[model samples]
Target: MPRFQYRAADANHRIVKGQIEALHETDLVTQLDRLGLTLVRASVVTKHKRAVKSLTQQELINFLFQMEMLMRAGVPILTALGDMRDTAASTEAQHLSAGLYERIQSGETLAAAMDKYPGIFSEVVVNLVSSGEVTGNLPEVLRELVRALKWQHEIAAQTKKMLMYPAFAMTVIGIVVVFMMMYVVPQLTTFLLSMEQGVPIQTRALIWVSDLFLKYWWALIALPPLLIAGVVALAQANPGVRHFLHFLVLRIPLFGEVLKKIILARLTDTFALMYGTGIPVLDGLGHCRKVSGNLVIQDAIGRVIERIASGTSISSSFAAERLFPVLVIRMLQVGESSGALDESLKNVSYFYTREINESIGKAQAMIQPIITVAMGLILGWIMFAVLSPIYDSLSKMKT
Candidate 1:
């Protein structure tokens, strides 16, 4: 289908300019007519494929929030979508709304409409919406999705805050080290050697490293990215490599623990939504396997699914896997026993969410000092190595 940018006239005779995808000019005209507008002119912008970008998390949140509020106000789904299509700020948002409106108008359910835009909607969101459609809880599901997307954005921002300063600080430190090794150290080494004095061991080591930097600066700069890209490619192509790497990643110290909590928080939150919306335990678990983005967690969820399929209760299945924290397992047991599994999973999600926030805060607070000390150590070493041999030469000359 071709997308057309059209100039149209609404009922009040106001000119509207927007883009829509359709088969041809006729289809574009029809789409405009359906939107209660008359098409004045439309030129085909692109043929066959949608070139729109995907929505960011914040955009997705706002979109869902609007939809939820409109639905709650008793607006029909199509009308709500049409309103979105007309008022959308970004071309991508307009395209999303137009694409969904077109699909829904063609007799597909809202979930089915959203499924076509996999770039915009995750399987989790699609699954929740589908469940909501069946259970007549679409508004509630949309509201939950809005909340979840917001939480995800918050967590992501916090994680970035924790890592960004250190990354930048290290990059600066790296440049300084390279400059010192390649230029400063070489000049001082020549002076020390020219004086015909014995050079210190540390200065000799520094000169050797400096020589390597001067000789292979390009290689030093390029090798890290090439190796990283190669490892990523290998991981993508080989499941075993990916699994092993993911397993190791989960073992990495403080960073690993925070990552694990992030995954588990999403998992428990999704389960809470699934359970609250009347999705089946086994089905929800099946969908949640990839939520963690870690093979180990996915494998664990897979086993939990199998246990549930084999007649184990959900909480027991989680416990048997030995994967969840004691608090989570206890909450699951309580919720399962009390016939309020969703509430229990929500508590787990909240616990992990709070933990992740605090961890990020603490990690950020510690990163500044650690980076400072690391840079200080590097500078201290360079200063000591440069001055020691030169000072020794002066003292011996006086003697």
Candidate 2:
């Protein structure tokens, strides 16, 4: 197929310049005329499909939200996309809308139009949209999608909230410790040595540590980050290592419990959305593996999927995994028994979301005070080590 660049005029004789694929200039004219525009001038653009930039999560969410709102207002899909293309603030958005508009205007379904830009839409999103198209409920599906994505965004923000302060406090504490060891402790040790007094054990230990810091300060600071990067790189390259890392991530005490809830909350919400859109439970579970974000969880879901495929109950399949909690299993049992899996999952999602928010709040509160006290203890030890020597010497002199 050949792509052509064309200049056309609509009914009002307004100029239209765009690219379309066709067999010849004759085909271009046919396409333009079909779109209610008469061709003025035409030239070939390209033969190959133009690659599009992958849209970010936020961009996809925004696009879906806009599309849902517009379509719900009775705007035709092509009209909405064309309007968006004309008024788009970014080249990415313009290109996206133009591509979709071209495809859709050329008789492709909206889901099929979106299929041309897989980088901008995930398989789950495409499938949901396809179901919507098939059921003639695209607007409702888009609305559900918007809600699920916003919920995911909120979950991500809450997770970051739990981590932000503790990370900042720890980094500050590390820098303070490094500064004291390299500058303050050494200066005090030198002063104490000049006084020609017997050094206390604490002071000697501090001086030794100061010497080590002075000699290997660069290694002390650089090694941690380097080691972390190496571990991450290695994990990425090796599936087993990546799996183990994810496993460890889910076992990290209170934080792990909170993270598990976050993952489950997202998983259940997405699953429920897909279910409500008329996608099969098995297919929905398959789509969910990608969103789990942890290899451990992904593999567990895979196992659950296999078990379900082998003629097991949904609740049994999930329970056999042993990774899902009592709450999830019990909810699944209820949903399965009552034939309301979507509703049960939604309830789980709601409960988990509330729990996640509360957990984040409690973790934030607990973490701040713990970090503050830990920092205080560290600084106190350094002060006691540096000052105790001077106090002992002064008392001996006075006696």
Candidate 3:
């Protein structure tokens, strides 16, 4: 969609200027008319050139919290938005709030206005707000949103903590290996070759590797970033490649289990939140599919949706996919029979959350020792290769 900048006049003859996304000028005009404005001028704007920055999660959480408090205190929604816009600390927050205020003032529902900034407000947020709007429970929905956003932030932080150490260790190991192969090994091997004596096979192999590194060290330096970029680009452009990569990640021993737990926790939590908010199950599952972040899981959810549409019970639909654990399936069955599916999903979320935390701790414990041992073995190999020949030469001299 192309963005358009337009100057329009309200019914009271006040000029309004803003940017909106539309398929064409006609669409822009139609949208303006829908907002009760007469378009005076319109021009297509380049989206990339504008570089609109989105608000951070914390900023959005604060905005929601403030809005909830204000609304609870009987402040009007428009007034609350305007105050938030004026008092926002960051430019991104101010931009979002001001844009939202203008749109709301133009008679758009809060959800409809928020739908424009998909980067900041997710489908879940938009749908939940729309539901709240329909149910006359905007303040309560806003509070729930605040809690959900905070939980998401915390989960992200925990995941980072779980992965950071392994990433850092691997980076350090790569640097050390590069340094040895490029510089240290070359110097030592050159000295050994100058000795004019037969070298051991291990020493010869080390020298060959060192020479290769010295000859094409640039490739070593460049390949990692290029490979990473290529993989990311391919993942974004090709769904099959992305799905394969996600599948690979999910099969990666201890780490894979942790990642699965994290994803499951998030999925269940989202499903619970949506279902509890008066959204229908199929609609909630559709939203979950979009936000699942894993193609495999999304596909499974899609299958579940199809099954449910064919008149299968919710639990039976979920069980047909066989992607979920037995416990999850059983809980769903229980929830279905008891008319507390949302509560059951919430319990599933909590179960996965606890599992993720413990798995992360155990993984970190195991990984640290494994990394240490691997590093020790690499150093030991280099030392043995360098020293063994010297000892051999000493033995020859003694003989």
Candidate 4:
């Protein structure tokens, strides 16, 4: 592609000059003519380095919402995209819209035009749109897409809500611990030394721990990231390690169950959506695997696909894997027997979504008290160790 500078005149003969990307000046002139303008002067402009761009989640959601609304208004797909481009907040989306508009004007289908901007639209989205174009159901597909995005956004917000307080509390507790060890402990230890008498075992232990921490405080702060990086490298280097780590995550006490539910919800929702769009079961499972975000789940889904290929019933395949919950498998069984597998999967997604929300609530209620108590105990011990000797020495002097 080449960049071209063109001077054009509208029907009123008002001159306009702009740089546009095209194959050549001739193409630029052709585009200008399509825009109902005549090109007075055209020359190729130098191409510069192109920057890669991506839309944020919120932006994409807004775009989808607007598209759904416009589509419901009975506007043509290209016209809707053009209207969206005019109101777009980002230059990247504007460029994408322009390209998409050009493609549609050139007789390319709207879905095919969107396919050129995979960064802005996912394969699932493009395919669904293509299905809509084929089935003459663009409004319905866009409605479903908007619902899907809203569901995802809700899940993400819930996840953030679950984490935000714990993260803030942990940081506060860490700062308090560091302050007691580094600044408070050493000043109080002098009295214990001057007394030359037996100190409580717990106090001595606390003092020694504080001294060690003070001496190597920097190492304490850096250790977490170092350990995490080392573990990540090990996991990457060895498949067994990676698998073990994944298994370990699923076995974690408080969070593993929540994580499992969340992942399952995402998988079921995506699978349902794809299935609803007329994609085959096996193909839906394959696509779901790509978006599952868990390698273990991906492998399990692949196995499920293989089993389905071998003529096993959907529910039987799922039950054999034992990866999904019994509720989900039962739903699949019912769906398969009833010949409404897509609706059943949708119900499964809804079930897991409700479960995820309840689990998050329970976990949030349990975690705050646990964190507060544990941190309080640690800080109280440090305070006792640092204050006891001072009080003891003062009492002796008064006696």
TM-score of each: 0.89, 0.86, 0.84, 0.86
lDDT of 1 by residue, 97-130 (tens): 8788778888999999888888889999998999
- lDDT of all the models against the reference? 0.87, 0.85, 0.85, 0.82
Question: Which stretches of model 2 miss by more than 4 angstroms?
Answer: 1-50
lDDT score for candidate 2 against the true structure: 0.85
- What TM-score does candidate 1 reach? 0.89
State, as a TM-score between 0 and 1, how close model 4 is to the true structure.
Answer: 0.86
Find the 10 residues in a row with the least total lDDT in model 4: 44-53
* Poorest lDDT segment (10 consecutive residues) of candidate 1: 21-30
lDDT of 4 at 397: 82
Ranking by TM-score: 1, 2, 4, 3
Query: How accurate locally is residue 257 in candidate 4, as Cα lDDT from 0 to 100?
Result: 88
Angstrom error of the Cα, residue 201, model 3: value is: 1.7
- How many pairs of residues collide in model 4? 0
Per-prediction count of colliding residue pairs? 0, 0, 0, 0
Model 2, position 119: C-alpha lDDT score: 78
Which tens-of-lDDT digit does each residue in 189-248 have in candidate 3? 867876656898988888888888888888977998999999999999998899999999
lDDT, ranked from best to worst: 1, 2, 3, 4
